[model samples]
Target: MTEEPARRRYDSLRRTAQAQQTSADIARAARTLFVAKGWAATTVRDVAREAGVSVPTIYAAYGNKNGLTWALTDAADLSADLSRLLAELESAPEPPRQLAAMVAYDRRLFERAGEVIVLLREAGRTEPELAQAYREARARADDAHRQVLSTWPPGALRSSIDLQTALDIYAAICNIDVYTELISERGWSSEQVEKWWCTMVIRELLEIPTAAT
Candidate 1:
């Protein structure tokens, strides 16, 4: 009886691992199709075939293509280095260092979600759900900008630049699509993008000189 129960529990654990792997496979297939064909062109059936799973399995796992997109976004958000950035911002308590932290996070975000960000922008033009998701993503970014602005000590920002202006500058510079273009298409190195982004954002927003970065 003890052996049987142990075997059953092991089997259950194996099934759970298999299910997680299948979910990952489906998500990967869906992202590939969405990137290759755009949202409207890609269907759940295509994802299923690409994943080597049945259509019903795709439906059961993700419900539809939009669901898969959401999963991808969620994965991107999770994979980003936000927590470390936030911790750095909190601990540094200086504008230049905080800007570095933000740029570091932005670089990680590009590495993880650059294509997905571009895909959403393109698909949002046609898909209402993706449009809403894109809007929400911008809102989240705005909130992060506000957090970064608030973390700086007094006299950190340039006298000419107010909090709102600084926030706007943050939004403009931290754009994933722009960073992706600079790195992937324009062939700029990650170090180049990071240095330029830090320099520009610091020059525009901080009272400190850009050379500090």
Candidate 2:
């Protein structure tokens, strides 16, 4: 009886491993399709064909194209990277320094997030599921900012800038779309853009004097 139970357990572990491998393959294929055809134009069948698997296999592994895309998003490490940055913000010694660190982190995130950004923009037009995921991610980031603000020392600084304004400025400075538009589209250098934006945000929203300028 014990041997039978052990065999069953081993079989279950093997099946779970196979399923995870299939899901990973599907996600990789979906990312390729997304990049080649854009998220709106890519279909589950396209991903299945690209992956050299049956459509049912893709669906069974990922539930749907959106699920596959979500998996791809996870693979990209965007959320994990952002979460780490947020944690860094929480641990930084001072608010102004934390804000500077946050801006720098945003720049790094944008550099690494080009493909995910493209997918997100495409999703905004035709994929409700992706758009919803994007919004939820933004909301989580916003919540993190709010929690950070809650630790601010009570004073005129806290009184002058409400949490909402601080969150909005943080969101604007951290927004990849805005960064792309200003830096990539407008030909502003990353350093120039971040410094200027960070200065303005710190001054206006947080009433914090930038150390150097």
Candidate 3:
């Protein structure tokens, strides 16, 4: 009967919603442990305990800790404001303003990923799949950089600066490691980091005219 089919469809939708909620809860719990302790140190049992789900459920949902790690990382990436930043960066005409936007966008990015980034990087040393994931994340960042760089009309960067070198400079200065150093060891506030970063990007990377004394 049509009524039977409709009932089944409703039940299916409810089940799918419940499953997605469960996965989200597990990923949220896993992120805390992975950030507080390294991913290598956090076990499936720990996540299950944190999430108030059974160990079997955790295994059934994520297969293992690595799967959960990927789930967390991927979820964060999906939730970030990268698309908006990318669009804004690409549409901006002025090179100095674009560079400022890039610096600000990266700072916001680190505000989200900066906390656990070092853990992910350190785990990559011994975990092959996580290493691949880390590489893919960096590749995505590189692609974003390339997107803005390629869209700039002529005279955006110094005529003498090659594209590849510019990209390398961008990555090196805007990287998470340097961001961590600024926050953790150097004791720079986020505002300070943002200002210093913008200044460096203009001075070191951009070809703005030198101010006459």
Off by over 4 Å in 1: 1-33, 36-69, 210-213
Clashes per candidate (backbone, < 3 Å):
0, 0, 0
* Better structure of 1 and 3 per lDDT: 1
Q: Report the poorest 10 consecutive residues by lDDT, candidate 3.
A: 9-18
User: Could you tell me every candidate's TM-score relative to the true structure?
Assistant: 0.69, 0.66, 0.68
Candidate 3 local distance difference test against the native: 0.68
Task: Name the 10 consecutive residues with the lowest summed lDDT in model 1.
Answer: 5-14
**Deviation from native of the Cα of residue 164 in model 2, angstroms:** 1.4
lDDT of 1 by residue, 86-168 (tens): 45655565678778877877888778777887777777888888877778877766776676676466888899888888888
Candidate 3 residue lDDT tens string, 1-213: 354443442343244334545477676688788777776788999999998989998889888766776655544443345444545543454667777777877787687766556666777799786787678767766765675676566776777787778889888888887888889899998778877777777777666633111
Structure candidate 3, residue pairs in collision? none
Extract clashing residue pairs from model 2.
Answer: none
Off by over 4 Å in 2: 1-32, 40-64, 72-80, 83-87, 156-158
